[model samples]
Target chain A: MTTDLKAATTMNLTIDVAKCCGSGQCVMAAPDVFDQDDDGVAFLLDQTPPDTERANVDEAIASCPTGAITVVDG
Target chain B: MDAVPVDTDADTRTDTSSGGQATTADDGAAACPHLRKYSLTPPESRPLDEPDYFGELRQECPASTVTLGESGSSWLFTAFEDVKTILADTRFSSSPLTPGFPLEGAPGSDAPVAVTTMIRSDPPVHTRLRRMVAKDFMPKAVEGYRDFVCATIDARIDSLATLPQPIDLIESFALAVPSDVISKILGVPVEDEAMFQELTERMTTLSLTREEQYQVIGEFAAFCDRLISLKESEPADDLLTRLTHEQLLTGELTREQLAGFVIMLVSAGHDTTAGMFGLSVLTLLQHPDQLELLRSGARSWDSAVEELVRIHTVVRMGPRRAATEDIEVGGTLVRKGEGVIASILAANHDESQFGPSRFADFSIPEEKPKHLGFGFGPHQCVGQNLARLELGYGLPRLFERYPDLRLVDDDITRLRFREGRAFFGIRELRVHL
Candidate 1:
């Protein structure tokens, strides 16, 4: 349960529009972490998102419609 | 949308003013302090009804409130708008270190210390923890497996065609589809699948006691421990080995951290998909024309995935937090440290937001179903892309294979929502192909 996570600074969420299909799942799951551009593609509201929003992001990651959003950490 | 205007008294904390007994300023009044006691059903039943609890609470208290038994933490924020603000804001944190945490589904223990996981962390720790899993689950990473996922589902459906007479819909198709997909992705060996299924089922049950929770977790933990050891000894390109040898090289995840990731993937990934698949078929069966169109093979299946799952919020309610300091949600006051459950089922059914078109409308809504099935805010489900792979590819292929698929039974009410349920689903759904 206790994770020896190195550092959260390596965190960056990448959204692939081609693969995304504009399901808006990432936008729904973690609104602050993902945003919708006019074209309906998801853009980062905050790639390095806050801790409080992590659970929602996790839920979003769980809820994605297209599976377009992926979290990348070093 | 602006926060709802509160009636001042809604914010005042009430606890035994002078009298030692339960006090309602007046009977039938919607007082904030006693929100949890206001049952969705009259207090005569042995078990609680989940949908009614969510539906009733959403209707009665826009920003739902509850008083915990042990922790005594007052919860507020269920209205769709409030949930959005609360989960995104940083001021109110989901730092699991509640002053006195309510042991959800567990009682008889005072000052019970809550268990910790990535879901329990806040800020930097959460960021670091989620980052590791994020890499594997990203849509791009998951998208590569789409063809494989589609093949898995298609192969099973094809095999089902070879069978005689009527078969159980849930066992034959619904459950088989996702379990097969997850097992393949996790690189689960064919010989160990039933064991995998047994272990994962216990892993996701929220109603179990803390000890039972730990026991199931232990089974899974042990499985992952053995798995990692094997993978470490003999490296492979599978996810488990990749995490153990390659990605984990930087020491980002400890042994427990790695095991937690595996447990989450196995448990959260499979169960919800089974529920979602069953619910979608039920939704379609209720609407004949839509099922006909979906089976018509004229319309593209891409649009149907989001639309179907949005309406059938599989993971209907998710526990969230009011991240900011004293955020006013839907006009009600929720202080820092209070928990919130986003009743996505109500939000999905809201006529004010999602138009009142009964379930069958195939035309993508002018506004997509804003239901928070997966969740809203930072902590959404990581395995969602994989879920999409199942829904997007699986449903259409299903109809294509069985053009005349329909439910044999009319009364699905008996299979209605369970009491105090954490997951959203019906008991037994039978469909005839």
Candidate 2:
């Protein structure tokens, strides 16, 4: 039997509503982790992907592009 | 980062023209000698093989502001202090959407000689154009495509790692990455990117004869004409389709003009970032210690990204305007209908603001890394988000994979700047993987 070792990650990429200028830096930076709404604001999907996706998630943070978007743990 | 102040009236100053602001060169002989030690420019400006001429300038002419050729662009500040001031001043505005640099030998109005993607316009126009394109460049748009970018980069890196022939990063990773991304964004087939390279070369060549420039312009226009028409019948999720059918639905811009805009995106979007990719790798490799620090340090990738942009300054100089009334800049006054250019390369390297070690050395201050690679004010680059996508993601993976990667020959004499009016980048970069 497997044990749930981790404290469930409430961590995800957050979009700052006031700073959301609709320039999809987050999506462009990490498409795997972020997506645009109808109005083109960024939202996170499945924050905890497999560890293999870490490289991309790191890229998203690096390229948050607007120098605007950021990652957070709720 | 703040811009260098307009100081032309000093003793070392020479009055050329502007609304009366000019730059001066000061070689501090008695003071700090190392300030000019490690410039980013390669030693001599050669052919396409090398692209780091600015490093040599950084070392040799660290305090000298150069105004090369008859075009008369103000290479401006050498001291870091002045640059910060200029960047802060609202006077040094950007005409980010055009080819009408103060040094641009062509003619246009408050508008530019040519239509471009969002980066070339001054605001209100810059504001609108950027907002329209922002939907496509947002980080959200790139979601789910990380693997696509990763796969593309990995495949190329894989081939390079295995192949015996020396690999040129510009072609394999640099050009390929952006070409792949743009093709996806434009909904154009990846194989068709050859046409883009050809058209980009022809349209953006700076030294072309006026007649040749016109011919290239005509050809570019003709090519876009057909592409827009074809996309008109069969629409896609690409930028061209949105601009043609959807964005135009609002009557904001015309199809003919929109075609020009597409050219700007393809040309500006791909070329600057692609060249920058190669340049970033080259610069980092030049300082292997920095690469190692980047690999091991827990410092943020955004810091590295900002530093990369600040150091390399992908688009070295951007165009600007006189606006309706005459404006002042690095000294000397002129009437209306004049132009100016801001040297990003010079400003980024200025030694006054950043401690000599703080900028190039990755192990320094982990706080706010000042950089203008995204530019300032109304006309900051609209595609900055996408450009960072390549750098921020691609660099770390590159380091992780080819930890020992470096330039084969360490001679500054051999490097040459790419030939074009648009962006300063290498034509080719051969490396030992």
Candidate 3:
């Protein structure tokens, strides 16, 4: 069931680094999928995580103050 | 909701600072008594608590007109979703220079030019000013300061050991921790900490006349100006020096803007954290069972801090904006050129977002609710990670160190709120160690 869920989920994640305010809301929400550089600009640890991380990613997207993070489901 | 009766004789006055344009829809929205003349200021003397009217308004009229500074009526959004919508929408200008920006302190478009800081400006400008200092306040950046925060907190706690029992926590510990921490970060010398505290006290006092407030502001600004010059000449490994070397030297930031930024950082960083410390300690003392949970590690400091922040939102009356264009929020059509104020304290306690007994319950729930304690959107508190670090390390350790600490006066009514202040905080918490 888990494998099927993962197989069905194909998501592409992207961040507008310019729009990133460095509030770290993304890092707080999904540490596994998101990480910050030494300068604190967010860079994706996982550009596309399994469907299991959908909720976390969604939270990150919602929580990003600048709305910098985006995800497209394929 | 019942259709509010619009007055036939409506006051059609608009913000005079900009192109004086009247609101389009429901010109008499502020005519309704409850909606009209809704006082944004808290009760002059009371326990540190949200006004009962906030709950009433949230339940009755989530979006309504309110009389703000200088007879300016603004759309007050009390609902959780509505407040979030207002914050997230870029159409709402954070700049006081923008016509109809509903705040009293800062200059409007007509007033003499003051360099707009990150919190007061929108997009491109806000984006630029924020980015200059954003790297210094990110979670990872703040993480590196955890040891400094802990040591600072430890030193304050140790000092309390020598002071008399039933000492004022606000003076001895609460204010000192953040003051020291912010000083360390900004590279400001703490040679006269007492003088800094006095100035902060005067600045935060809401009852001060406009002239007195401006006098205090000038003095504070002059201090900041001096600090900027010092940073220019004697570069130190600090945030101020970084701004001076990188942004100032590169001509990305003007000297005036640099001074404004430093003043903004100190004002934002110092009192708010100090306020939170005093309030949080008071709250834990009030709830012994919860305090036990926190002390025993049954409840995490992070969650407790989040909950504490939600319950007692220190920022009394703002996250205000002028509508750059007409926008509908919570079924109310707020017209272009009108101002709006999001009641974050009310939104934090809204039962809809936080579930039942949000007002009464102060526990860490299974699914933690997203709160606007540090506010939301691009202009949210940039120093929040640092504030969180201060609270997270400061609170539990405080309890651990002084297990028997209790409030000197348990009477809530007798306690004084920082009346008429920019932020709501306990003025003085006399505690027995």
Candidate 4:
């Protein structure tokens, strides 16, 4: 089942930069688990990424229009 | 003239599916007397069909409270998770100078001073004027201007093969490739692109008047103060010479907010992708098997430009807010200084969010959802990554440089749409290759 939910989950990630709305949509859906800074906000170039970057960190937490990227499943 | 007109008859007196909620106002201060009002009509269909009265107010009462006049009622919302919780809820306030901002022709309180931009400010000044042009429209700074937006969509498809045969397509190639890729990313002057596309087409022509739209918004703020004093004495590597040498020489911007960010980025970068490239080229010439599945490469001009920006939501009466407190959303409530809206053409056609036969189905389904069509929170859409790199290379390079184009009247009410603009487009398509 999708490699048993990526070997029983780990993912991690978190963002919030005051609910970042620089609308990079998490660097256009997970450019290596999100990047954007020169004031476009969003950061974490891999807060915990790999499990083959969990389907682009869950499509950058489902295309973030300010639900400001999250993903716990630790 | 439609920034909420919707009546399309159906209320038969507001029962609104009982479960769909909204009937609040036990003196939550007047005006919800069983909702459904919305006045000021006009968009009576055919710019790539949608007006089935917002799919009958998104199956009635998606978050009700209507009225919108004698300066009163507002709420609206229309499903898709209550228009994504009134556009990612910052307790709703995108200021049309707040104090009950509904903004359908808004201008009172002895109206005068205007240039608000940062899409009518909210967060700490719309988060310091959208973090000074948010890393120049980010998706890796618009994928480093995709080869100057594919050489301005191949020089507007090689000036539509030297014009002649029934050509219009919004004056040769969907308004000349976003007015030559937003006048070369706001450096402007290619000998002032014919007076910046005639003052951004009389500032988005809704039949100008309000004294000729304030004398073409004072000649487009004196042509963005003469292109910010010729980019402060010749500097150029554009985006107004890096915001005229970084935020207008460190006063962190203000030459009337860099001429209201070059008249709000050349009238929202060439009239919303020149009305989404004339309504995504009249929806790929009314879906020729979805333009032969993006001409046989079997789908993906980035999911057919995000399903033609979710069936031409075209800013159809959405983004307006006020609440500032007393929220509630889909189950209604609303209150504290009221006026809400959100709609985005009824939450990108919410048949409970893209089901009930996928809201005006244009078929590109490999799973869809995720469309408020360039709108949602902290003012979503800072040139939506240069409008998806100009509709991902201007709709498959204008159907791969005219595969026998066609459309010189397949009679969709003889084309011309765009009336009193709040972005829904096609005011001249014609075509014929």
Candidate 5:
């Protein structure tokens, strides 16, 4: 029986671009889930990661210096 | 918030006695009684064991009115959430040219335009200027200087070892580290350190009259202009050279703009870090158990530095901003053109955010919460990563080098804080190694 990884861990990632000062803490913490645009504002690379990636996503949210990243559980 | 017309004349200002009591204006108009009066400069004395005065103010009135001497009154936001909101909100403009901009120790009219650089400019302009050198200050870029920083700290400590007992740590070590580090970064010659140090000290002196302050600032600008010219003629692998060679040549930056940038970097690069270094040492010495834990390797240096910054927030008040539009913050309506001051110290110590233990105790928590020590939002400290690297590496090494370090006076009250300065720090920390 194959388990759906996306269904198993439902998390909504949000990035407030206006608030992102490009400190890059989020990208550093979870490179797979977050990236920065040319202007250095943060953007979400993966809106929903597997449950196994929860730790990294949480770290990124917490590490964000401007509190620009938020994660909502589905 | 209520658009109170502030009288700028010092002589005409109502003298609210040091007891912090509400007094009627000279015209017999009743001043807002609820408006809490607290001096941000040399903040009112409180017991060392007790939380800072701002913490109490935050608990009582997170958004209250405060009079900053002749600088005029403004709304003070103390709650962590509100402070963060104000910092991140674009409506809260950083330009001193904006009407009702909250300024401390600056002339009311015709203030030097040079002073309004990246820190005072809003987006597009601010974003452009900040991004020019932002990469140099990032954590990865700052990590490249780790070896040089260590060597500088060791040299300073080694020199202090030969000095007499009960040396003033601020003079012997704390102040020198950042000064030397900034000098190296700016490509300043070792022989010219004395000149730049004197200029920076004079420029940062809050007690100076407006005229006197401007005079010193003018001299500093001239010095920087000369430095920029020298860099243009003989470029080096430093920040100034990089800016002059890359930005100025490309017409991305002008000469005056480059000088302003240099002034900001040279002054801010050293002053705030020096304040943090001195205060962190004082905080650690005050709590010997915590110091012991750190030395014993029970507590990580990273956590210790974070806790140190959390406990002793060097930048007491965030840069003043004028609300561009009416906004409700912490149940108070800050009207358009109203000035706002984010009480960083109060927010850093908010019990709600950090909990009772970590808020009160100096012990490093297992989980380090996000702190406003480096501030938040676009205008948050640009050199934070560099400052962190310096503190993280410098503090541990200093303690390890002098394991038997102790204060000359155990009484916290005996320590002289830098009164009237924008930054909060111990002026002269006498220590015996």
Candidate 6:
């Protein structure tokens, strides 16, 4: 399922590119909110995923090898 | 540049091309003139100052050929995008049975039936076989073994603490952890670990003669057959038993297929993980600042492990694939029937993808780049979650137990590597706690 872009914008998702080891676990765990750059480093497709996408995004954060992705509550 | 002879001594050099397709060039030069004749396996031979010789090639000749002694030559792809594309694209076949496919050491016949495991298959068959056991290797599934893995590491460390100073980390801990974990997963009795480890070691040794390799593989297959029979009557909670009861008995898999599965799992699960553990430790010790960061909690152990795997890639050359049809990779035309070796080592160190200090820098960057350490696409390592868990649990506990841990030999240059092996790792790491 897709996340609501407007709702996601409120979530304050940030990805530290340098910390991203590019394991792609984030993308795998939460494809709607996370995507990888050409080099395989992760990027936020949607900074603030909707409440519906929270669980998977949480999983993405937990699963990230480098802990590069984070979600701050608005 | 002219073709450089890798080995001057005839007796010592390994001829990797037993079933290699004959080259059209009489003088053993690659068809592509710009392609240099180089052996990608043993990175230790390269000059110490220029550790990243392959990086030079990735820049100058992204797709080049390297002659493999008598076995002819194969195309080597060095760029990150090219390597990933080749691995993901189905146009490149993974089957070594195909004629002209690059044979690194010997003919596939010398290897076990499992040499034809799902890793070497393509499309529907690979998808079917891999799907059967894919769930067991998922992050969640591997996470189930976390407690067990951590406990095992602690127990091993506890045992090592009793040992005298200058302990070989590889023998005492690194090798033992993964060996035990894989054994437990396969339901092999702990007492029989030495036997299985021996077989696995022999099977992975690139220096062994074809006959020797075949013998070891035969023993391994027979061992798996016996294990399968045991699981047949009395099933356990382990993977082998699950495969036997759930997949094999249901006619979804054949006896040989079960054997292949067991063999592949046992070998893949331990060797690469063991190599990573030893290499990571060495890499960290060489860079005390990074080690201090890890120990001080400045850098998360999870990130450190990923960075370690990325920087100290064990698998130099991934499985060779033959181009099914003429395909363009990184602007180079790889003609049909040409063999391609995706240099996982080179791609991981590609500066453009990972920034300038990708190879030399030990510090973990805030932006972690995707690496090919576990490979990519459909044939990506199934046991990656398990391997990562082992590293995540093992590395920190190792350093925490002995914060003063350092190499006994200050000269890192003297360190002995498992030369000519498919996986890169220290033969012995004498560490003082």
- Candidate number with greatest DockQ: 3
Candidate 3 retains true contacts at a fraction of 0.59
For residue B295, give model 2's deviation from the true position in Å. Answer: 2.7
Indicate the residue-level lDDT of B235 in model 5: 92
Q: How high is the lDDT of residue B247 in model 5?
A: 90
Compute each candidate's TM-score over C-alphas. 0.72, 0.68, 0.90, 0.33, 0.86, 0.81
lDDT of 5 by residue, B1-433 (tens): 1111111232122322111221222324454455644455332233232234466667776776676554356777778899888887878888877766666533322246354578878886887788777767765567778889889999998888899888999987888999999899889877877788788777665566566766877888799889988998999999889999989888998887888788888888888899889878887887888888777878788887877787667766455788888777766777777778876777877789885433226677666657888887788888887888889888988888998988989776556766555556677889999
Indicate the worst ten consecutive residues by lDDT in candidate 2 chain B.
B1-10
Better of 1 and 3 by TM-score: 3
lDDT of 5 at B111: 40
RMSD in Å for model 2: 10.2
Candidate closer to the true structure by TM-score (higher is better), 2 or 6: 6
- Model 5 alpha-carbon miss at residue B342, Å: 0.8
- Residue B329's lDDT in candidate 6: 81
Best by TM-score: 3
Q: Indicate the DockQ of the complex predicted as candidate 1.
A: 0.04
Candidate 1 chain B lDDT trough over 10 residues, lowest sum: B2-11
**Residues B1-433, candidate 6, lDDT per residue (tens digit)?**
2121122111123544332332332335555555555454333433111245587787787777766545457887788878888876777888776655776543333254845578777766776677666667665566678888888889998898899888999998989999999988779889877877777777776666556666777788899899999999888899889889988899998888788888888888898999889878887887888787776778788777877888767766455788788778866777678777887777887777875434336786554556878887667787887898999889988888888898988665576766656566778899998
Task: List the candidate numbers ranked by lDDT, top first.
Answer: 3, 5, 6, 4, 1, 2
Per-residue lDDT, model 2, residue B275, is 77
Work out the iRMS of candidate 5: 2.9
Better of 1 and 6 by TM-score: 6
Select the stronger candidate by DockQ from 1 and 3: 3
